[model samples]
Target: MITCKDFLSELNEYLDEDCRDEVRKELEEHLDECPNCWVICNTTQKTIEIYRGMDPIPIPVGVHDRLLDALRMKSQIAPPA
Candidate 1:
């Protein structure tokens, strides 16, 4: 049985259909047996489906600038890896 940590670690690859067959099988089985993880996966899948069907709206310049500025400030505060 796969752990929740295992599910999360490979979630992006799984969603992208990028993981190997064996890993995918393990993740699918985990989803079947884990209610919390299943709910998370289901909601994320639905959200991605919804987004894919819509045209992406461009961010307003002011909002985009503010977001980048915030990110820069956060990075400055954070220690280097």
Candidate 2:
């Protein structure tokens, strides 16, 4: 049997329905037998769904170039390995 810690750690994948079938079955069984974990799983699943449903916002133009430039400068300033 999987422990509560393992169940919680992998709960996100289960909620996302992105885990392996065997793992999903284990989580399903755990959720069925454990009310606390069930509540936690339900709440997290809802939260992720809500976030995913939000509309995408466009990033300002040049932001990517600016970030790359900053990273380049930072890397240049550091000593060589």
Candidate 1 off by > 4 Å:
56-81
Off-target runs (Cα >4 Å) in candidate 2 are: 56-81
Error of 2 at 23 (Å): 0.3
TM-score of 2: 0.63
lDDT of 1 by residue, 1-81 (tens): 879999988787788856798888999999999999999888988899998899888999999988877987988755345
Q: Estimate each model's TM-score.
A: 0.62, 0.63
Tens digit of per-residue lDDT, candidate 2, span 1-81 = 887898999987887656899999998898889999999988988898898899987887699768767887988755345
Q: Relative to the unseen true structure, what is the C-alpha lDDT of residue 80 in candidate 2, on a scale of 0 to 100?
A: 48
In model 1, residue pairs whose N, Cα or C atoms come closer than 3 Å (at least 3 residues apart or on different chains), thus clashing, are: none
